[model samples]
Target: MAETEESTGPPATLIDPIEMSKLDTKFREEIHSMPNGEELSACFACSTCTAACPIANIWKYKPHQLIRMILLGMRDEVLSSDEIWLCLTCFQCQERCPQKVRVTDIFFDCKNLAAEEGKVPPNIVGLGKELLEKGQLYTVTADWEREDMGLEPDVPGLSVDGLRNILKETRTSKLVDGDK
Candidate 1:
């Protein structure tokens, strides 16, 4: 009997055969127009980005795989993926990339593209709404708790209205208002 070696590539689920219809030949160029985007094509699939990623362990598609997908012009799949949204943006991947691929920044571009398509999770949208309205995340201290701690009910010298005003003219405003 002849002996055969096991498949050395990534698991079958991580890589599917390419379909011409799913590719966007221009998607790579679209990303290239964004900051730090030109480096994307330099990726050599060394998996260094994945190895340096702090949260890669939990990702169905690690940073390197995602970069490869981007290089392959898997636009729809890349934009709609949860992995793009889940990146911690800690720069670990980018810092360790031997090719200087700017992995983290490319992911940021991918996320912005996803948001433009209204693909953001509802909770993220809610958070943006809360910030736009209140100029902060959820309340940092309860009124009653502040009073109990010998502090004023509200944080002194802190006003969110000014911040809110500036944000009103930003893209966040359009996004929160359900505009593309």
Candidate 2:
């Protein structure tokens, strides 16, 4: 018996289809446990969701690809991908999905899973740390832009005590230092 390039089947000694259902089952677990797992099984691989996604144009794998990967159980690649974090959470894909797949929600789930698994990229980690420290997701806009827009230099109706209480109740106080 000789193995040829044209051999389309596994070797006779290989007793199990090691790359089959087991992989699907395992990855399916990750997908189902994701934030909106209900939609994970419904994807039909249509590119409509991807086509409607603003961020998909810039992504290495569009929304549908990410969903397909989850369906196929490609956990490591999905978890480590920058595409997961790059999602803007705009929900455009969700709205356009003919299957009603919760595309945006699933991306959120993947991001959470990646964070839980400590697989977040360094840039995201640093940004999260900064948000936690500053209690703001982004730095203040340029002073000139604010002045040009005639906006008040200070935030409206926000006080340190009010913000502290809200953050504490939301379990995000840990992101700030010297807050009780």
Highest TM-score: which candidate?
A: 1
Q: Which regions of candidate 1 are displaced past 4 Å?
A: 1-16, 142-153
TM-score between model 2 and native? 0.72
Please write out the lDDT profile of model 2 over residues 1-180, one tens digit for every residue.
344467898756644433554454587776686568887788889888888888688889878888888888877788889998888888888888888888888888888777666676766656555555556665565487788899987677644555445655553434222232
- The CA-based lDDT of model 2 is what? 0.73
Question: For residue 160, what is the lDDT in candidate 1?
Answer: 87
In model 2, the runs with Cα more than 4 Å from the true position are 1-24, 139-152, 160-180
Q: What lDDT tens digits, residue by residue, belong to model 1 across residues 55-154?
A: 8899999999998888888898899889988899999998998988999899989989999988887777888899998899976675677777899766
Name every residue pair that clashes in candidate 1: none
Provide the lowest-lDDT 10-residue window in model 1. Answer: 1-10
lDDT of each: 0.85, 0.73
